[model samples]
Target: MTEVCFVGDADCDLQYELLSRETAREALSTYDLRRPFENAIALSTVSLGAAVSLCNDLNWYVVRFVDDVLVREPSVDDDEWLSRELATAVRDGDVTGPDTGEYLKVYGLEEPEPTPEDPNPKGPPALVEPLYVSRQDGAVPEYDLRDVDDTVVVRLTEGEFTV
Candidate 1:
């Protein structure tokens, strides 16, 4: 299965923003939604092609409410995620799964605050600012921007590399 995760923009409540609209809601109706991160929503698709197609179908809402779009294809790397652009490239056969891990955007994941409504947190950790890095000798550097218990690494295309 290919998992697609949408990180919400800080200013908006992502779930409400997407589900409130009829078009976006209908487009996402078929899949089961999961909140993997504090401001994120995730869904599974059968293949990389399906994941990219769904993202393209919801581009309007994504542009307005999402901060990032990440896809995880088990055929690629089970632990690491791919940027939306890279995922699309892979789905289209422009890039190979093995060649997708050179450039990465690493986001620090902080522990979530326990809320009164939901005390026992089952959601994934919250994401912080991402640090762009390139792998060297098949090893990626640790995220040093802040103190985080975990990190989410999103593989990027060379064109998407920022630093």
Candidate 2:
């Protein structure tokens, strides 16, 4: 079972509620997301088409939408993004905190399987852009998060992140 949690979109109070089917549905219906509920991709297998649908539907960038597993090779841009993150982690070292290998060891498979030379290369397309919410006019979507109960929503609180 593939799991996905909203990574960005912090300003949208209902984002935390998006992890649950019932709550996600309620939030989707209540908000003016402009995208159809039929297209939402939270907690799903995350097919390439589904990734595209979620990214395009939510006006998200191709990297913000993350999945629990590596469903396919990341887009060139996403590969660069992950590389930068890895560089920063290596620079940070134990002095910075926990080890960062947890990410790269698992996700980096840039050298596609079957080597593209194999007559039987079977899998997702060679290049895949991750699903992500785009930057909205260079500004974060601002919304009041006071109404939602903390227990029901699972997300980092406003203070836990730097805008």
lDDT (CA) per prediction: 0.94, 0.28
Q: Using Cα atoms with residue i matched to residue i, what is each candidate's TM-score against the true structure?
A: 0.93, 0.22
Which tens-of-lDDT digit does each residue in 1-163 have in candidate 1? 9999999999999999999999999999999999889989999999999999999999999999999999999999999999999999998999999999999999999987679997986767899989999998999898999889899999999999963
Q: Model 2, 136: alpha-carbon shift in Å?
A: 33
* CA RMSD, predictions in order: 2.1, 18.7
TM-score of 2: 0.22
lDDT per residue as tens, model 2, 1-163: 2222233333332334343446335533533432111122333323334433343344323234322212221321222122223322333342122222122221112223465479566432221222222235533232233222111111221222223
Please report how far candidate 1 places residue 123 from its true position, in Å: 4.6
Q: Largest TM-score belongs to which candidate?
A: 1
- Decoy 1 TM-score against native: 0.93
Error of 1 at 112 (Å): 1.6
